[model samples]
Structure formats: structure tokens, C-alpha cells
Target: MSVNSQITRTRIMECASKEFMEYGYQSANMRRIAQAANVTTGAMYNHFSNKAVLFDALVQAPAEEMLDRFRGIHAQFKADLPKLTFVHMKETAYLGTDWMLEYIYAHFEAFRLIFCRSEGTRWVSYLEELIAVEERAYCDAFGKRGRRVEDMFLHIIAASGFQYLVECVSHDLSYEKAVAVLDSAKRFSMAGWQELFKL
Candidate 1:
């Protein structure tokens, strides 16, 4: 793309971000976004096929990155499951929480859109997707250890664990405050997991 074209695309994305943040995906106006970007509707369409595409462009990368990071954390834990102890699990959980907090803060706007302003988009299911990933990880880990856990129970645990993380994002907690809250939550959750898993 030419410099001017690239600049216009960036401008459209910025304006679209503000529009989505303000009105949410269901109510955001494409024409208004175009106007805000100082581009014609046709030009905006040329850059982004539609409102959903535009919204995805803004958040897809960060969303995928977060999930990938979570998967990586679980993958590492699973790899070392044979030797993993309660203390190691607790320490890893804390480290993961800290990494997640730092990532969310760095991409606060993208996450805010996902958590708060993405009702009409597929991003609305992002939390559920995260929970599913957690659920799968737990199932795999327990199965590998020949430990049987009920699916419903695993779902509840996974949902609650991720919901605690989402609370930090939804409430817009400061980094320090979020860290403190998640630390306490992690301690509680690790104790529960340890008891349940007999680790």
C-alpha cells in the first residue's frame, strides 16, 4: 500500500476503535466511523469489508496472542506433570497471572473492547473460548495422571478460574490492584486444586 493508503487505513481503524468502544459492536455506525476518520464510506469499505472485519482487525491479534500464551503455559505444565508438585504448580500459576496481567495492561484497549464492547461480534464468546481451553487442559492433565474428574466439575473449575482473570479486565483494575487480587485468588484456587487433585 502507498503511504497515503496505509495512513488512511490506520485512521479508519483508530476511528473504528473509538466507535466500537463507545457504541459497542451491535450499535456502532459505520458511516459515523467513516466520518470520524475523514474518509468516505466507499473508502472505508475499500479498507475494511464490513464492520465485523474492521472490529476483528483491531482485536484479533491480541486475542489470539493471549490464548496462545495460555496454551503455552498449560503445555509446559503438562510436559512436567510427572514431577510437578503443589508448590511448583502454585508458583507457575502466580507467574502466569503476572504475565497475563502485564499483557492485558499492555493491550488494555483491545481487551476492554473484547470484554465490554464486543457483544455483536464473535469476540463476545472470547471468554467462553478461554474457559474451554482451560477445561480441555485440565481434562488432559488429569487423564494423563489416571485421575478421573467429572466434566461438569471441570467446567465449573475452569470457568471460575478464567472468570477471576476476566474480573480484572472487566473492572479495569489497576495493575497493582489486579495483581494483589489475582494473587489472593490464585492462592485460594491452588489450594482447592491441590486438595481435589491430591497433589
Candidate 2:
């Protein structure tokens, strides 16, 4: 794309972000986004084949990067599992929550869109997918230790743990407030896990 085309594309994405934020993905209008960006609908289409594609363009990178980072954390935790104690787990959880909060704030709008305005997009399932990733990691770690946790129990733990994290973003909590909330949540959860697993 030329300089002008790139500028137009960026403008379209900016306008589209506002539209999606206000009306959500299902009700967001492409023509209105085009008008806001000072482009014809045809010009917008030249840059984005459809609304889904445009939404994907805006959110895909940040969403995938968040998941990849989360996976990396779990991978490292599992690698250290043989010698990991409850203290290690607690420290890791706090450190991970700190990193995750900073990252979420850095990409606040992208996550806001995913959590609040993705009703009709494939991104709507993002929270469920995140929970599934957590659940799988727990299962793998427990299995490797010759321990067994009920699948339903694991799912509940994973889902509720992540929902707490999601609440921080969805409610637009301040960084300090979010950190405080997550710290309390991590302590609660770690206590529960320690009792259940005898870690």
C-alpha cells in the first residue's frame, strides 16, 4: 500500500474501533464507519473485505499475543513442577498477574472490544478459550504428578479464576485497584488449591 492508502486504512480502523465500541460488533455499521473515516464504502471494502475481517485486523494480534504469553507462563510452570513448592506457585501467580495486568492496560481498547463488544464475532469465545487453556495446563500438571482432579472441578476453578481477571478489564478498573483485587483473588485461589492438592 502507498502512503495515502496506508493512512486511509489506519483512519478506517480508528473509526471502526469507535463504531464497534459504541454499537458492538453485531450492530456496528460499515457505511457509518466509512463516513466517519471520510472514505467511501467501496474504499473501506478495498482495505477490509468485510466487517469480520476488519474486526479481526484490529484485535487478532493482541488477542493471540496474550494467549501465547499465557501459554508460555504455563509451560514454564510445568517445566519447573518437579521441584516447585506452594511458595513457588504463589510467587509465579502474583508475578504472572502483574505482567498480565500491565499488558492488558497497554492494549486496553483491544481487550475492551474483545470482552465487551465481541457479541457476534468469533472473538466472543475468547474468554472460554482462555479458560480452556488454563484448565488444560492444570490437567497436565496434575497428571504429571500422578494426581487426579475432577474435570468439572478443574473447569470451575479455571473459569472462575479467569473471570476474576476479566472483571478487571471489563469493569475498567484502575491499575492499582486491579492489582489489589487480583492480589486478593490470587491469595484466595492459592489457598484453595493448596488445600485441595496438598501442595
Candidate 3:
């Protein structure tokens, strides 16, 4: 990539991240981000077509990459441990939630912008993808069923139980307390799936 493109992208991410954190997504401004980067609005436009595109590139891209990283690790380490083994569970938990918290800490404003400012509309489908990943892992540990699996997937997401737990641990609790929650969530999710499989 050209140096100018790289610089502009980095500058936009850094400044937009701060701005999005300070303001909700709706209030985020490309002009302000451009100004913060010491670039004119035209330069910002050359890099990103719009605020949505910039947000996706700078914020969503990193978050999605983290998820992919988690999934990759889980797939790799899964076979080394028995189903629900400590290694399996702890690594998975860390990859998914604990690390997610780290991402939030680093990009706290970006996440708040995506969820609160955008009303989480953009995250819904992505959340579904997360559920599918967990569900596949769950099914791998348990037996796959058609209707029941579907129902449980919808139930978990709809109840917002896991999401609520994530929010509670990530935001409402201390870091140590949040780690504890991650531990519990991993165990609980594993146990639940194991039971579903009659394993």
C-alpha cells in the first residue's frame, strides 16, 4: 500500500476511534476525524467513501478478525483435549470473551459506537455468526439435532443471556470478576452442550 494510504488509514482509525468513543455512532463525524488526522476531508474521502465504510474498516474489521482468531485456535486445540477439558475450555473462553474484553479496552469507543450509536443493527448478523460458531462446537461435543439445535440457538440469542453476561462482566464488574465470569461461562456452556449430547 502507498505510504499516504497507510498513514491516512491509521490516522482515521486512531482519531475516529476516539471520537466514536466520545460520541455515539450517530454523532461521529468524518470531518472531525479528518481534521484530527491533520488531513482535509477530501483526503479522508480518498481513503474511505463514508463514515460507515471507515467504521467497518477500522473497528468492525478488527473485532471480526479477533473472532476469526478465536475460532481458529479453538479448531486447532480442540482435538488435543477431551471434550470440555481445561485446556479446551480455558483457551476457548480466553479467545472468545476474555480477549474480547481486551479488544474493548483498546477500542472501547468503537464498540460503544457500533452497539449503542448504531443500535447494534450491524452486529446482529455478526452475532448470529458467533452463535453458529458456538453451536457448531456445541454440536461437535454433543449430537446435532435439527429443530432442537435451532430452537436453542434462537433461545440463547433471543434471551440475550450470554450477551448480557458478556456486558455485565466486561463493563459492570471488575476485571478479576469478569475473568471469573468468563470461567463460569465456559464451563456452563460446555456442560450444557455435553448434556444435550448425552455424553
Candidate 4:
């Protein structure tokens, strides 16, 4: 793309992001996005094929980046589990959450769009996917002991963590406030996990 085309695409993306975040994927208006970007609808189509494509352009980068990070964190968590202590877990959780909060902050609009306004996108079920992965990993690691806890309980906790993140971003919490909230939630979750798994 030339300099002018690049600028136009960026403008279109920014405007489309706000549109998607405000009206959700299902309700977002393509013409409004074009209008906001100061481009013709026909011109916008030259960049993005359609509304879904535009939504993908708006969110795919940040969503994929977060997925990679979440996967890495889960892998690391499992790798370190054999010798995990409550103290170590707490420390790692704090640092991990702090890092995650900062990442989310950097992509706040993208996250808000996916987490709160992606009603018609593939990302709408993202939290469920994350929870299922975590729950399966826990069960694999702990065997019959982990199975003792109901699947619903496992799902609830996993879902809660994702929801907590959405809450932090949706409310626009500051870094310190977000970290503090994460720490408090981590402590509470740690206590529950310890009681459940005897970790």
C-alpha cells in the first residue's frame, strides 16, 4: 500500500473498531464506518471484503496475541506444577496477572470489542474455549483427584478469571487498581484451589 492508502486503511480500522465496539458485530453499520473514515463504501470494500472481514481486521491481531500468551502461560503453569508451593504459585500468579493486565491495557479497545461486543464473531465463544482448555489441563495433571471437583466448578473458576479481565478492561481500571484486584482475586482463588486439590 502507498502512504495515502496506508493512512486510509488505518483510519478505516480505527473507525470500524469504535463502530464494532459500540454496536457489536451484528449491529455495526458498514456505511457509518466508511463515513467515519472519510472513505466511500466502495473504497472501504477494496480494503476489507465485508463486515466480518473488517471485524477480523479490527480484532485478530490482539486476539491472536492474547491466545499465544495464554497458551504459553498455561504450558508454564503445568511444567512448574510438580514442585509448586502456595507461595510460589502466589508469586507467579501476581506477576503473571500483572503482565496480563498490562498486555490487556495496551490492547484495551480490541479486547473490549471482542469480550463485550463480538456477539456475531467467532470470538464470542472465546472464553468458553479458554476455560475448556484450562479445565482439561487441570484434569490431566491431577488425574482422579482433579476429577473429584465437578466440571461445572472447574468451568466456573476458569470463566470467572476471563470475566474478571473483561471487567477490568470494561471499567477502564488503572494499572495499580487492576493489579490490586487481580491479586485479591488470585489469593481467593488460591485458597479455593488449595482446599480443592490439596496443593
Say which candidate scores most in lDDT. Answer: 2
Clashes of each: 0, 0, 1, 0
* Candidate 4 backbone clash number: 0
| 73-152: candidate 4 lDDT, tens digit per residue | 87888787777765766677677767778888888888888788989889898777777867765564555233466778
Q: Poorest 10 consecutive residues of model 2 by lDDT?
A: 84-93
Q: Where does model 1 exceed 4 Å of error? A: 144-146, 195-198
Q: How do all the candidates rank in terms of TM-score, highest first?
A: 2, 1, 4, 3
Colliding pairs, model 4: none
**The best candidate in terms of TM-score:** 2
Q: Candidate 2: deviation at residue 96, Å? A: 1.8
lDDT comparison, 2 vs 4, better candidate = 2
Cα lDDT of model 3 by residue, 91-191, tens digit = 56556666666665565555555544553336536555656665566555333222245657645633453474447433646556666776776668657
Ranking by lDDT: 2, 1, 4, 3
- The whole-model lDDT of each prediction reads 0.87, 0.89, 0.63, 0.81
Give candidate 2's root-mean-square deviation (CA, Å).
1.7
User: Which pairs of residues collide in candidate 3?
Assistant: 21-109
Please report, as a residue range, the 10-residue window in candidate 3 with the lowest summed lDDT: 140-149
